[model samples]
Target: MHVPDGFINAPVSAVAGVVAAGAVAVSLRGARKELGGASRSAASGGERTAPLAGLVAAFIFAVQMLNFPVGAGTSGHLLGGALAAILVGPYTGVLCISVVLLMQGILFADGGLTALGVNITVMGVVTTVVAYVLFRGLTGILPRTRRSATVSAFIAALVSVPAAACAFTLIYAVGGTTDIPIGKVLTAMVGVHVLIGIGEAVITALTVGAVIAVRPDLVHGARSLAVPLKLRIDGELVDAPVAAPAPVAARSTRTVWSVGLVTAFVLAGFVSFYASASPDGLEKVAADKGIDAKAEEHAAADSPLADYGVRDVTDTRLSGGLAGVIGVGATVAVGSGVFWVVRRRRQDEPADARVTETV
Candidate 1:
């Protein structure tokens, strides 16, 4: 959900700005560990997965362009908040979605710049925390099957939307510009988001399930609970016994980069045309509750790429499609670059005794 400028009051927005800044700071540090550690961990038979993380972010960005009809006049897209956090890690996932929000706000004018902090907080932080908590809790008590990962993905995303809605309501209650009834805002916001949450759940579960099927080792949320990979010996499957450890395989990173960039281009260029053209969760709530009365027009409204249309491209479909493609390409490039740096930094660490001695 992209919160416009007028929904939350000044003081609350300022506070949220600080909170969002802090969250981003923490995420930057945490992302270094997650991306780098995962890269190092992949030194074994485990597959290289950092580029998959970037691809996951790019995929989330593309899918979010399509908003499915929820109810009444409102529509919602895949939140991807929970899905990203689960697939990658929480910190990296937050960075992924924050990048998407930044692009949408500045380039497409989909969200407000003044309200960027709020959008990041409610959507990124709230969803990640809530989903991660629930996922961990459920995975702890339930079986460690891929089904658990899928089920957790569904439920975690389901709850995250409304939790964000409630958080916005609370913020509005504290800093609402209008005198709208708190009860009305709360009811409307929560109700609409509940529907939006369904869309989020389906999308998150499907994406998570798909990734788990292909590369369960890459999913950060499901990492701890994964059953150890085994080899079939004498027609019976058993965990591969640890012996004198073999040298870590050095796979080419080129394939990961190529595949990620290609997929991002395809989704944004070709697939986004079919996305539903309805207002998202935040836009719908603002209209329904009079929260948008004082909304400020976006400063970048006249940008060449405003509204997801390419500059000087007269064809509506082509312009929008090209813009989407460009946006995806930019996001993937930037995201992969950041993650690659993090991964490389990890690789640069003082060689550990285990690796140094072996080498």
Candidate 2:
């Protein structure tokens, strides 16, 4: 849920801001190893990881625009934390959601500026951390097959949504500006969010399954879990020997990247047009429960892309499509830059160590 300003008092919001900043800083450092392929294979390298991470961020932003209905006059969108974490890693997943939230807040004016920290804490950090933990736990107990991994992804995503909703409830209980009963708010938030979680689970499972099927090596969570290919040796199955590393420049992920970018474009530019117009779970609950009574205006309300429609573009479809495309482009560009830098820093570490040794 995108928390707006005034929902949390200034003091609590500031505290949340500090927490968010610290979380982001830690994630930045943690993402270097994840994106650099250090944990998977030293020979595999991470040149493709940077751009893939960027695409993941852009894809998440695009899918988030397609809000599907979850019954009872309420709609819910992909929170993307679970999906990103499953596809990438937990650290990179946090960065992905953070980038999406940042883009939405600044460009689309969807989330309030002052409440950025609250949204990141509840939506990004909580969902990613909870989903990753659950996914790992389930995978550890279940069969170590692709099917099992996909099932784990589904369960992880399903639990993560309500977990985040509960986190919001706890935060609001402590710092809510409204006088609504905390118990009622908690029940309503969790109830509607449970339904929303189903949608999230389906989306996450399908996406993770698809990625695992095509390129299991690219999926961070499934990389080490996938069973190696078997060879029939004298009518007996034997594990295939490890293949030699591909040339550094030969391991291009251009095909997957192109396909993913096109899918994101289609989803945001075309599919989003038919998305349910009803308020999302959080918005519906807020309006019905009066939690939004003291909601403050978004600081970026006057931005050219406010409300997901391009400024001065009267045609609804064209305006919204343009805005969505712009958002995807911006997110991909910014995310790619950040991840590329991280990857480079990781690559430089060994050389720096060598230089220090020589000195």
Candidate 3:
């Protein structure tokens, strides 16, 4: 849920900001190892995390626009934390979501700029930490088949959405701007988001399964937990040793990247038009319970791409489509740039660190 301005008091908002900033700082350093292939862990065998992480960010931004209805006139979008953390590492996943939230706030004016820290903390950190931890736990306990990993993704995503709802409820209990009863808010938020979590779970499961089917090596959550690939010899099945990671430059993810980028553009540009128009879980809870009584207008309300439409375009389809396309392009560009830098930092680290990770 994207917490808008005025929902939280300035002091709490500032505190959340500092907390979110610290999280981002920590994630930045952690992501270097993930993105740099220091771990040599890709489900697709030799794929690198940097490119996939960028696509994951862009894909999350695109899929988020396609809000599926969760009944009771409430709609929900993909938070992408579970999906990202499963596809990439938790640290890099945090960065991916932060990038999406940042773009949405500054460009499309979806999330409030002032409440950005709240959004990042609840949506990014809380969701990622909760989902990844659960996914790891479940995968560890279950059979080490690819199906088990996919099942873990489903369960992890299912729990993460409501966990985030609970987190927001706690935050609201502390700093809510309205006079609504905290108990009612908590019940309503969790109830609606539980339904929303189903939607999130389905999406997360399908996406994780698809990636694992083709590029299991590319999936971070599936890494090491995966069963060895079996090749049938003349008369029997034989386990094949894992292939060494290809040199970074020699590994080409162009096919996957191209397909993912195209899918993102198509979803954001055209498919988004069919998304349910009803308010999402948080918006519905806030409106029905009077929590948004003091909400402020988005500061970027006047931007050219505000509200996912072009400023001067008269045709609704064309305007929204163009805005969506621009958003995808911008998100991919910025995400790739950020990951590139993170990966570079890993390469620049003292040679011993690489040896340590490799060992």
Candidate 4:
């Protein structure tokens, strides 16, 4: 959920800002390892995989716009933490959601600028940590099959939503500016979010399953589960011809990136029009429980693209679609740029330093 301004007082918000900053720093360092896995070296087992992480971020931004109905007068959308961590690494997943949140706050004014820390800590750190840990644990215990990874994604995503809700409730219990009882807020938040988690789980499972079917190599969580390329002849097994050459493998990464980017554009630009119009879980909860009593207007509320619509565009559909498309483009660009820097820094590090640093 996107916490708005004034929901938390200055002191707690500042603390959250420090926590968010620390998380971003840690994630940046960790993302370097995962992005480096995409190095051009054939021995690395991947090529330009960093770009795929950008696509994941853009895809998450696109899907977050499609709010599905979770209950009477309430809707929910993809938080993307579980999906991202499954597709990329958990650190990169954190960065992906951070990029999306930053975009929404500054450009769309959907989340308040002042509450960026709260939003990131709740939606980015908590969700990614919880989902990734659970996913890894489940994948470890379950059969080493593709289905297991997808199943893990579903369960991880389902749990992450309410976990984030619990996190937010705890944050509010300490920093809330309203008179509402903490028990009521926690119960309502967790109750509605449980339904929302189902939607999150379905989207995560389907998306992870589709990617695993097409290109399991691109899925970070499924890397260990990839079946060996083997062929049996004369009762002996050898490497199969299924493995592509290095050049072809590099080209495949580009192809996948191109296809994913196009899909994100389509989802954000066109399919988003069909999203539920009802208020999302957070908004509904805030309104019903007086959490918004002291909520201040967003700093960027006057932006031309505020509220997910273009300022001068006449048609509502056209305006919103354009905004969504713009958001996807910006997210891809920024996310790619961030990943590129992380990858380059990783590559440039002295071998001794790299070796000396603990992962």
TM-score of model 3 relative to the true fold?
A: 0.92
Write model 4 residue lDDT over 19-101, tens digit each, in one string: 99999999999888777742323433334558888899999999999999987899999999999988888999999999999
Which candidate's TM-score is highest?
A: 4
Candidate 3 local lDDT, 139-216, one digit each (tens): 999999899999999999999999999999998989888888999999999999999999999999999999889777
Listed per candidate, the RMSD to the true structure in angstroms reads 4.3, 3.3, 3.2, 2.8
List candidate 3 stretches off by more than 4 Å: 37-47, 228-252, 353-359
Per-residue accuracy of model 2 over 213-317 as CA lDDT, tens digit each = 887777888866756789999999999997865554433478889899999888888888888899999899999999999999889999999999999999999
Tell me the tens digit of each residue's lDDT in model 1 across 1-359: 78877767777888999999999888877776677653356442223556766676678888888879987888988777898888888888888888788878887887788889998998889998888888888888889899988998899999999999998898888887788899998999899999999999998998788767765665788777656679999999999775654443345345544665676677778778887788887787788778888888887889999988988999988998899888887777777777787667666666683355336
Q: Against the unseen true structure, what C-alpha lDDT does each candidate score?
A: 0.79, 0.88, 0.90, 0.89
TM-score of each prediction: 0.87, 0.92, 0.92, 0.93
The window of 10 residues in a row where model 3 has the poorest summed lDDT is 38-47
The lDDT ranking, best first, is: 3, 4, 2, 1
